[model samples]
Target chain A: MSTHTEDTKDIWLDECFAAARQDTTAAPDDLITKILADAGTMQQEFATQSLVATPVRAGLFARVSQALGGWPSITGLATASLAGVWIGMSAPAGLEGVTQALVGAEAVIDVVDQYYQAEFELAGDL
Target chain B: MASIEELSDDALLVMYANGDRDAARVLTLRLTPRVFNHALRLLGDRAEAEDVAQEAMLRLWRIAPDWQQDQAKVTTWLYRVVANLCTDRLRKARPVALDAVEEPVDEASGPVEKMQDRIRAQALQRALSDLPERQRQVVVLRNIEGLSNPEIAEIMEISVEAVESLNARGRRRLAASLSDKREELGYVDAH
Candidate 1:
């Protein structure tokens, strides 16, 4: 290994530390001209994208699906949640008072239980 | 000084932010060649270097509006962009195998110019390849592209003191690794 000069801060080191850096291996100058010629390409792409990007009416299944995390998963979760909610809400009048209290507790339990269904074990599972 | 063309970097950038195509072209023209050189030296691949340079400039053009005059200097911002792009590429790439494939040139002929340029290029590559990534970066920024310590520090996102320290260590290591070929490298006479 070569011995180095001391970490001597100097005037010339400021100027001369790097090698002579004028690019001797020059590429043809037309490369720059061509790059300049292509300058409008990005703007044109942006314009085209804008032209095609207006929102359209969503399909029923897609709208349902997109309600969750695209469409299908969202639709299923919403259907399940609404079904459970309707079952709780449409119970008999006599049971309404009891059901209201039960429903409140059930809603809490349902939310907690469903929140981690993928993590928790199911009834028949080993 | 009088012409719109002679406006400062920040002034040109402000004009660019207002959608002045001329300002964009001027900035691109001013910065591209050096950015290309920096990226080329870092990646040791011409096409990749060009891509990185273009990407860096693209980012620059995008962010010109919000650029802080003091906190963000044009070339310094570009240096960081090029460095980050090269870093990303390096992460996905193994060390390149540089075949001795010379692009044919039609310029005035000399056996000495060809030999020396070839040797210099190869030697520079080997020397650079020998460096650690950070050290190589410091060397390239400080030496080849000829940015100052503060500017390099800003680009590298480090303190001025850190820049000094890194440059010192990098130069020391490089000088040691390259000492044997000191004469060949035109650093010092072997005799």
Candidate 2:
């Protein structure tokens, strides 16, 4: 086509397209409501799937341990408790020496013996 | 922090997938008109277009969970969905009665301009409806929708070359058809 013809063609088509472009139809209210309803229904499906997929939460002790610093801290506490138990059961000789160093020997030994006796008597009653 | 309205469509979609009701509302309000208008243009019937719009959005909602943010854009995916749905409807149904297609009325324009624009729109719609499906899709997206050639290519799953070619051919076809009615359309003395 000649340039003039082409320009004319473009002008008319451009006008028509321009008119069409100005003619956007807003989505009706019912359509929005229908889509929102679908979204709500699908959200329920997502909720259900999430509930099923989510792993169970930690128990109280596990949570507390986690708060306190998880397995490494728990392990340290367990070790200290076991050491205390061993000392109470066997009264290791080195503990007495350490106690003697901390406090003068005579007074510390007398009080320590009395405490151990009372603890033994209490254990017997139990 | 940006309001929900300011969030990207991809972000809103991700939020919707995670059961965010506000995200759903925002996305519905934001995307529905665009989807509906595109459907109306392609299908050319209000009720059917409404149905197509609702169905397309439903697909989007369903696909939200599986949507790969890196792979595709939300609007592109939605446009492709609308196009496919329209193509399916067009293939299964007979041609739409042109009278059933509502010409958008502008309350702001003068009566003479309104009628002229209506006639022009109706004439354009008739010519568009007669176009081949691919050509119509190309023309509507390129001209009416004003999408970039690359964007049209991605939406239609065609090369940019194909988009340009279809766009040219479609415009030529539309021009040829409308030229016969120039005197009736008021182009005879207008310019």
Candidate 3:
């Protein structure tokens, strides 16, 4: 082993590096088999999760709810619909009185008469 | 669906996480060689290097579901994992079996050049092993592995300046160590 000048030293180092880079060592076949085996096991685990964890297809109502904006919005719409149905079915006791107070009976009669008069005029024109 | 070769590593990992067995195969084919080589260079023991590569890949498989694509490149993350695994093995200083260090065959060169290349490679490995761990890592990543200094810094979790300093010191040491062997390594004859 003899020492080289600085210029030679750089060239030698570069040569050595180039040689080392060229010396590519593949992972052993058995090692690759082991790695792939492990990956296979993980794949199975992932498969199991896919099978059990995620639904294949969301239920129709669930899909609709998700499209509309998830459970919160669904719950809100449900509550509003239920309230509307209750209001329509049960007609709370002071509702008519409240309506009469808000709009006099004469006002209601006048509106109905005006509606019938417009219908009669349209029929005559036809 | 894109073929495995057409997909990026990140995409392969995502597919693997989603239960695509072929994706796992593709990823293993792509990354195992790099991991094994890096580990072998760091540990200087074939069996241990294989173990390190396997363990590192196992961790990768485990973390696939949670892997954040924007966070790190897959190979970079594997390099970091292998480096840490090598560090832990070095710290433990386990007695490597005598048969564990197998010389790699260089099929690309003719017999004589192949022999010479092997010798030079062994000499460089010896010099690399003699370096301080950080310097060795920096030099290997920079010179042999052909990674940029910033990439080396990211893998080693050090500042780029520190990585540069380590690389300089490591190369200087390697040059000093191998300078005397220039003739024996056929550097003079080749020149």
DockQ of 2: 0.28
lDDT of 2 by residue, A1-126 (tens): 011233234676687788787766778899999999999999999889988999989899999998999999999999999999988999988888998888876763354588789999999999
Q: After superposing candidate 3, which stretches have Cα over 4 Å from the reference? A: A1-9, A50-126, B94-101, B108-111, B189-191
- Residues A1-126 of candidate 3 have per-residue lDDT tens digits of 122232234766866777788787977889989999999898788778777988578799889988999989989999999999998899898887887788875664454587789999999999
Candidate 3 or 2, higher TM-score: 2
- Candidate 3 lDDT score relative to the true structure: 0.84
Best by TM-score: 2
Query: For all the candidates, what are their Cα RMSDs to the real structure?
Result: 15.1, 11.7, 6.6
TM-score quality measure for candidate 3: 0.71
lDDT per residue as tens, model 3, B1-191? 76678899999999999888889888999999999988888888878899999999999999999999999999999999999999999889865443454566565766888778888888887777778778888878887888887899999999999987888778888888887888899967644
Candidate 3 total steric clashes: 0
Candidate lDDT scores, in order, read 0.66, 0.87, 0.84
**Lowest summed lDDT over 10 consecutive residues: which window, candidate 1 chain A?**
A11-20
Q: Which prediction has more favorable lDDT, 2 or 3?
A: 2
